[model samples]
Target: MPEVPRTADPFTAADLVLLNGTVRTMDRAGTTRTALAARGGRVLAVDDDAAVRGLIGPRTRVLDLQGRCAVPGFIETHNHPTFFGLTLAADVDAGSPPNATIADIVARVEQAAADAEPGTWVRGYRYDDTLLADDRHPTRADLDPVSRDRPVCLQHVSGHFCVLNTAGLRLLGIDRNTPDPVGGAIHRDAAGEPDGVLAETAAFAAHAAMPKPETADLAEAIGLAGDAYLAAGVTTVHDTGLGLVGGPAELDAYRLARRKGRLRNRVRAYLVQDLFPGLSGGELSPVEAGVAGLGDDLFRVAGVKLWADGSLQGLTGCVSEGYACAPDKNGLLIFPQDDLSRRVATLHEAGWQVAIHGNGDGAIQAILEAYAKLGLDPLEGDRRHRIEHCQMVSERQLDQMAAAGILASFFIKHVYYWGDRHRDRFLGPERARRIDPLASAVKHGVTFGLHSDTPVVPVPPLEGIWCAVRRTTRDGHELGPEQAVDVDTALRGYTSQAAHLGFEEREKGSLEPGKLADIAVLSADPGAVAPDAVRALQVDATVIGGEVVWGGAGLDAAPAAGPAAGGGDGR
Candidate 1:
């Protein structure tokens, strides 16, 4: 079981034995075993009951599986950890009120204001511009009557935009002369006055005006995000765009999490290019290697992240064809092509992995062109460059990714959450049928992973798998039957594919002898379940580093058998 030779210390000592369980190892050939033992955080043995039991000692914590199934911990490919932390730290939750309209939002803000002091602002998030009853952003005019005493800002679902009331605008000192910053937009009405809706950088501007979260509060937010993911069966999360917003304070927050032992799941943080002026706009420096991959397995900075375009649902994602809802707009570029190319090239030249957010076909093409401009050769051994949200890829874009040895982490949930809107209002039937193009990328031999752009959607890997496997939307309509993958492929996208992205394939992902003992105990084998039932499976327990971190018997308390619809623990 301990075959790999290494000078590096093994995770810990084997103190746990998971026996009599269906372990979907996600091994190289998709092997399934019934028993496994963990010592130090690495797997000591993986085999049948007798074989694995032999490795267990008196100190071992034995977990009787009761015939349940286990798989690798889910890895989220694209997410904003610090930003999510800030959201958790904020008092507002605009996204949670699904039925709330403009009036409802104003009332909620008014109440939040009353609850707080006169000076404290009221903040909320998760607004879907498309679903707004007004089909447009609400401005200060709509909120002034409800609450003029305090500032109010509602973040859009994309996290890239926000709408502010008059108080918020005035507090932020954003008047007609404030002027939009480069790479950001300040929406204006016909008369050239601020419309209260700030796009991209503009929204970030409003956010900057607010008081920063206290260091202790930021650490707590990070802890909350970690605990939430761990409860949902995620052992690792790619902080797709950390350090992109929040400035140096956010970096300090993640650092604080590691320092305070608040971090549970592993984090492979990809720093936002804009976070570091030197990395973002200045010359490259090899000195970064000293700090790169710092920290233990709890968290590490692995690469640099950049936003090339916006999202599809909001009609800001750079698209090949104009949006079905906004045919006149082709989506906005977050960064100019020359600047992005230069920055990517500089980062690449300095030996940092570059992860770009490219959701649309046009954006993908632009990213590819930018990467090409850098002229960096794909290095030998696990150098996996990635496109964060390769939602709408053209065949040509797929070829570029394949040729560059780039991995396209597809947003599989797009099919589930936005498929209907995409079909009817965005891509239209013909093009919408090919939206995600997962199967196409697989057929092309391009490496890929699926993701839930958390806060954008919830951060669950299984949800993405359900979307990919079923290719079904909220209405239960299968968007593209041809794009659907079998359960196994979808599982690998979260497990193996994700591990490969993190350069941890050799130590994690699979239930192999020499791999890390990160696993999830589920109520049923996803592989054996019917496609439709995949989303209904429940997680009974979650084990990371061979330790049971969450629900075992208390799992029965999970809302799986309720009048409320129960979905599987996202992968």
Candidate 2:
């Protein structure tokens, strides 16, 4: 890869100059430099302090970094922006004590219901199944005391599912006779009544009944979510699933965020396939031209997103072998092969980059086959199709990804958070090593991006980096240390590597000339920190496109609200 010039004149007139920091550019060759000069949100020049000072003029703002470590702004490849934003607006703290159980959750919901006016909904999130002492989901009986006049829905930790109280189920008219939707499950008891555990699209539908936020509310939520990302040193986020309900909703949110200049970081929003309704299956124009890849070097619609399989916790992740915990079951397919193939083929043929969710080995193989079936040449620039959460890929699928030029966004943090649970209950210990094979992806010449599936986990790219670098489980056991990447490699996966997946490498990711001036100042040098100390590292500041979004001084370090809570989680 040839190096692009930083700017037309990086060492000349600029809007700002950040000096005296360790600048980790994450460039093509993986090198670090000092002192960056910026003009109108683009990196103009990078060199030593005295040299960069020459570019600073009377109007230029100079920020002395005081030798803090800097890296390219973080880019998260998979997240639920709209859902996260909405959850944030509800303003309920879900990351309570690890001992917080179903009864505690019910109490919290009752309190929220009391505070809400009649007919207004009360929603809560971050309910962990393992922590529930009853080992059962809460039902309307559990929450009826909260408010029968108002509906309440609490999303399970895995966004793939949720448990809606009777009021919610009744509001939606989901009764004993309501057959399961095409791609979802409604958990029922021996009495053949709704058990309130709605999985897949069904769970999503219950929450959908609640009023969608207004454009202004959405705009605020985006800012809140974006600020959260920036605070964690993230400069860009690939919103994996956008336009879930429809284009108008998500588009309005992202557009409003950009128009208000509230989006400090770039968002590559992958429009959800479910949104492109009633198309005749031909070449489609960009979803909405002006805003598809819009904004002040801050946000863009990177591609189209599709989910091929279910989630690990839900026991729906499509695996080649039966789950260790459920020997007779091989997991569910969210989209059967033929339908998924048609969807991928249609999207790719229409010139839109495609990203498919494939968590199980079987799902990964299906994705690889679809990419091969396309028969497109690899030399094509920007085709960069991605496999989000390539968690359980096989050796053959690894070869197929390399051969087909498929980029992978591995949810590596799963190895840390769920490794023990997965090994003991889901994928047997022997098959666990094959999960999120980072080293294999590297050996096969596949470009792998790392991410925290926010709302599934927190949206910290450093935690993603830490997971890839350590390859250890939560119990302090080294699952496969041989698969661990060095700090430089893991850092690239979060920065430039992630940018390439979103096709924004030219505009962001690296601090090279002409790239957006999105960079993060760290509390310690990642390279110098001991491998185990990676997760302990902190952010000093987060600058996106030449503007400071989060200044770390005296910052409130509390965890953000909602089920996708953040913490060590061994990542």
Candidate 3:
């Protein structure tokens, strides 16, 4: 076990002591504390109210918490900060109501085109076809009205597909003669001409061609994203898909942001697999890392990320069995099996954690095989290689995972965002019943974690917890009741387990004295509430290293009444 700090003298009191609160330490023993003190960035003490009060000195900033519930701030396991910031800062938000139609999407794009620099791209994101009134993806024809001269790119809600206008396609040189890349498709019209719909790697190509943002602009994007995450009580985020920050300039953008004091929370990043030089198999040079590659505490590169397949919703996630919705397709795999295994072995041999994006069963199988071939075990040591969206895992695979010490960072929010679609369209009920199988993973002793896969789904931690606990879809349908976990386990998905996913458990996850003093102040205790009431627990404030970064109990609007009488997490 690790050491926990204790208070010294009253004369040298800690920097801050948040007392008189119901704080869940989220430790394995389920310890609870009424007060905690912090000196440096790390926690100083966890003691009872009276003893904690005795240590408070004239210089200490004390927060009463007013009986609010405090837990370790959320550590997001899978998110894209650059994309999150970029989308939030520039793109049209077509994910919500009033813009849930193709016409609305076009109108929004038109407005953005008018505002954007002439000849610059008009970008929009997060348009869900299922929620749209038209119930279909917008095409080049629909987007032409938005911008005939300027390129237009509308990212799909799944983040696996994107629609481009004719001008955008021309900019990227996609036409009838362009052959589809392996494992990805450029959807073609009946005449065999490209239809401006790019899936999987094809979409990535279009994104790569777009004009890169200035470093300061990128920094601002990161700052905007950090503000949102902090406001939502996310103290740490493991930024996946470093390919978005592809070049040296993009990588430097992060260090510049941190140097400028724009980074508020911790960042653990994974560079894209392609960034490493090699065709058959290769290793990442530290020189390629620039400065952000090597890390201190605030920002670090945890590993390399590889995408083995696409998304389940986008129907590109590699699967053994055929899709229930689209009978002809079983989805696609990005790399040849031999190529993938070699790459995985190369990285594993280099002793770096590898995070693979796999959704369907085939992708999961490939990743598991790759790790097993290396004879690695995380439980035995700290070999925390991960499967990013292990959504379609099998029962036997779960056992193998536990035995091999593999980690599954399930996209649990799929239950809320695409659970109904999965049931009715994607997986059919039988397989859909197992999406994000938290309970089964627990049963098999797999060290599983949950994530929102932000920008794909908004980064709302409470809503994510709610999804894991209730297993309810957007339409109030329970997709997998048996898979639903208790509130404690769900909270752990966001806190402790999330830290373990990033190999950051010792420093940031739990509210231990030695851990960083990152805390989220909730209106009520999650464990004290009924499973369904968990989502309604408003985040009153968030503390990062004892400094209040967001809503404070007294600084912001007062919280609503505490947990109601009906719900109870009193397990």
Among these predictions, the greatest TM-score belongs to 3
- The model with the greater TM-score, 1 or 3, is 3
> Model 3 RMSD to the real structure?
6.2
Q: Across residues 107-194, which tens digit of lDDT does each residue of candidate 1 receive?
A: 7777787788888778787777666676667787887787777888888888888888888888888878878877678887788888
Clashes of each: 11, 5, 3
Q: Rank the candidates by TM-score, best first.
A: 3, 1, 2
Rank by lDDT, highest first: 3, 1, 2
TM-score of predicted structure 1: 0.91
Root-mean-square deviation (CA) per prediction: 6.5, 7.3, 6.2
Worst 10 residues of 2 by lDDT: 562-571
Question: Over the stretch 1-571, how does candidate 2's per-residue lDDT look in tens digits?
Answer: 1111122232456766677778888888776777888887899887887677677554455566666788888888888776677667763444334436677887778788889888766777767675467766677677777667778888777777787778888888999999987668898978999978898878767656667667788778788887788778887888888876334687787877878977666777888875665322533546432234454455666678888788876787888889998888877777667777887887776667889998988888888777887885677654889899999887788788887788999999998888877878788888887688888888888898898887777787777788888888878777767678889989988888887887777887788988888888887778988988888888877877776667744321222233221122111
| Candidate 3: 10-residue stretch with minimal lDDT | 562-571
**What is the lDDT, from 0 to 100, of the residue 446 in candidate 3?**
83
Evaluate model 2: give its lDDT. Answer: 0.75
Alpha-carbon runs more than 4 Å astray in model 2: 1-11, 91-99, 245-247, 279-296, 380-382, 552-571
lDDT of 1 at 433: 81
TM-score of 3: 0.93
